[model samples]
Target: MPAATFEPPAHRGLLTESIARRLQNEIRSGAIPVGAKLPSERELAVQFGASRNVLREVLRRLEAQHLIEVAPGRGSFVIDQSTADARSYDALYRAGRPTVRQLIEARIPIEVEIVGLATSRATDVQIEAMRTANAAMIAATDPVVKARADLEFHDTIAAAAGNPVLRIMLSSIGGMMFEMMLRSNSDPSIAEPGVPHHPEILEAITARDTDRARHHMREHLSLALRTYGPDLDLSLDVMAANHIETLLHRRSTP
Candidate 1:
């Protein structure tokens, strides 16, 4: 079968998401059969009337969803639709009730691997971005601002790793991570000690030392787990109750 073509949307809002959704429909419908090679990035960009960067981001999202596999030198290829559907459903289910312990446990190895990747792959520009984010995190006084900065700081590191799938995976639990940060930052004692490690992790990434980068990333997340993990149990209970209430209300509605 010939490769599918996409028409650009009329509005600009959520362009990347729109493009991803279109491509996802095609893949799921077998218009782009499993094991088939997708059109080149250049071709897809022109077909969608989007910039190459936008096309690339959309492709990354599809890759994250397991709909496509992007080879380094070759083009992208469609994956098994049933397998992709299962993975997507699993990710959605997990995102609905992610626990603090589960987030922390998942972050340890993932962040460690990304930090290592950033050490080798991150550009000077990306490193500078991380530095700026870390500085903002250190200087922010409000708990909410600090928590936002904290997530952005780690997100910068993830971006530097240049793997959108890993970044997306981390982002799936970002809400829980943000809640954990807010709870920790609300307490001066817990937040103060953890502040210094952000720069240490950034410095290790700066030096291109994979081992040290992994070590500092692990140390930072481990400290967070030790300090806030206990309090999170209560928070999770509250969240679970809220979720149940929301579900019940929806069920009771006409």
Candidate 2:
């Protein structure tokens, strides 16, 4: 018997991209751990709200990225991601998508510096941009929107920092960071703790208090790794905590 065909979704690109993001998150988070077989194409299509053709595209993408492998008759399975194949995965920030934990490490020093610079350098317009993004985050009901808004708040600060180089660095990883943010933002346990900090950080930047801005950013970011759980190696968080105490120490300095 010939195989049945699925008419592709109306917004195929959007659906494909969304499925790819979700599958990437699942693979990286170990929900679809290495060597585990993926559900059948029809099953994945239903699970991810995409048509079979769109699911094929997503699977092709993962295969090209070395995130998964497809066997002729055995179905798809997640790869160990031992190496990133640039030829296929190098575009659109897809070359080596960092996990949530990796992005947290990058955010600490980079965002800390960005917030510090933005503190004194941000114009009124830039601060208002941040305000708008934070407001969106506060109002958003969907995890994806909330995650994008969360990243936008930081992006605005990066822009306000007036350091094109720093902004570019953040932009390089923005796509992967959004995926990380979505996973965390989807979790009430993790998202709730991180939400209130944005308003506080925004106010610090508004006040033009570099120390306070950096302090709040450091504390805010230190909590970012909590998604990894109690036993997750948080030496970075510990280092950030030490930096926060050092900032507090400076306050006590005569």
Candidate 3:
């Protein structure tokens, strides 16, 4: 992406969110390609016509969303979607982000099969990864980390399935899935009942019990549809958006 062309929405003064979302679109679309390095902070400020501090704030947003990895001395780089998978359908989500219901619909069928395959095919390391993610989900106090961990719990299963096509399909909706997880996991009441489902599913998979794994996965995924209702993507995300607003404010002030 080019610099010095950052356009802020007319109603907003600071360009932090705008610049972050702009980069998010490019990265999510694979325009920057996985593992590609981003422009330096100085370079990005020049491109966006904002301060280096504002640009730093923008990078934080991307990091929180898990779209980029910022190494200490090295520059930021796009993280791979599916490490072993070949093709990506990330282009499909570029036009507009999918709603929670649409994303869950796409995920349930694919993940259900993915978990079944994973039950039979998962290696020791893969199972350990699922265990680690579940522990993190239970421990997370921040919404961003909670959402990321929640997604990781399922993603480890997809990777373990050893089916590249199915894994790539599951990864295609990751951004929206993060949004869905954010909504459901942020609220204590809605999030509580669903907590044990991950461990149950993990236990079944570890035992190589395919039917049990699928049953738990289906139930875990189904709770959002009923609990979230029609405006889930909008309302619950408002709580998440408030957190973002807090970050933006803290970032904007020197």
Candidate 4:
């Protein structure tokens, strides 16, 4: 088989992440079959027009994710699909990461209260920060930038709430939340309907109407659940099955 090549379009940032994502897709799609050796590091660096150092970092990240194995005397090889699936499940559950459903469920009540607090307590500076984030979200043409701005908008509100404990709690789950947003935004069907709600939430908070703020925030979250609930449930089911299959495979191995 011909060695797979990565050709990213011009002007995309996060070159390392972009390369990893493309390579991952190829592996999952079986374009790079399981146990097949990847192109040599120097060849891949040349193909990707990336520096050797950047290419190495991308390889390292893929190795860490169990998507590929790097052998010192050989080259990187793709892992079997089942093994990759099992590793994903183990990593997520072992690290105590919440599933998408649980993350949204937990965020609803906590962020509703946070929005209410911000409505009452937000100073001009804090409110301006949120406005700035909202503006960024509105103007952002890139999916990653939009997702980040969306999170920042909410995070600014949490900061404006002035509750250290609540801020810390949200911060703890922020990474997972960002991941969820990125997934959801990648699908136009899921993202298009949700755009207006952010501005609505911002308006309510800026008006300093606690009830409206809470109502808008709750509405925003509920709409999200309704929109992405099926996808989230499907993801959970797949992960659970993978976990069970891994356990069964281990038992059978011994």
Question: What would the per-residue lDDT of candidate 4 be over residues 131-208, giving only the tens digit for each residue?
Answer: 899899778765557768888988999999999999888876664566566555545667788777777877887787
What do the candidate models score in CA lDDT, each in turn?
Answer: 0.71, 0.71, 0.75, 0.71
lDDT of 2 by residue, 126-245 (tens): 999999998998887655567788889889999999999999888866755665565456556767787778888888888888999999898887775655574234333233333333
How far out, in Å, is residue 237 in model 1? 6.4
Which pairs of residues collide in candidate 1? none
TM-score of 4: 0.62
Candidate closest to the true structure, highest TM-score: 3
Model 3: per-residue lDDT, tens digit, 125-190? 999999999899889766667778999988999999999998888877775677667667766667
- Badly placed stretches (over 4 Å) of model 4 are 1-97, 235-254
User: Where's the lowest-lDDT run of ten residues in candidate 2?
Assistant: 1-10
TM-scores of the models, in the order given? 0.56, 0.60, 0.64, 0.62
**For candidate 3, what's the RMSD?**
8.9
Residue 236 in model 2: shift from native, Å?
Answer: 16
Using TM-score as the measure, name the better of candidate 2 and candidate 3: 3
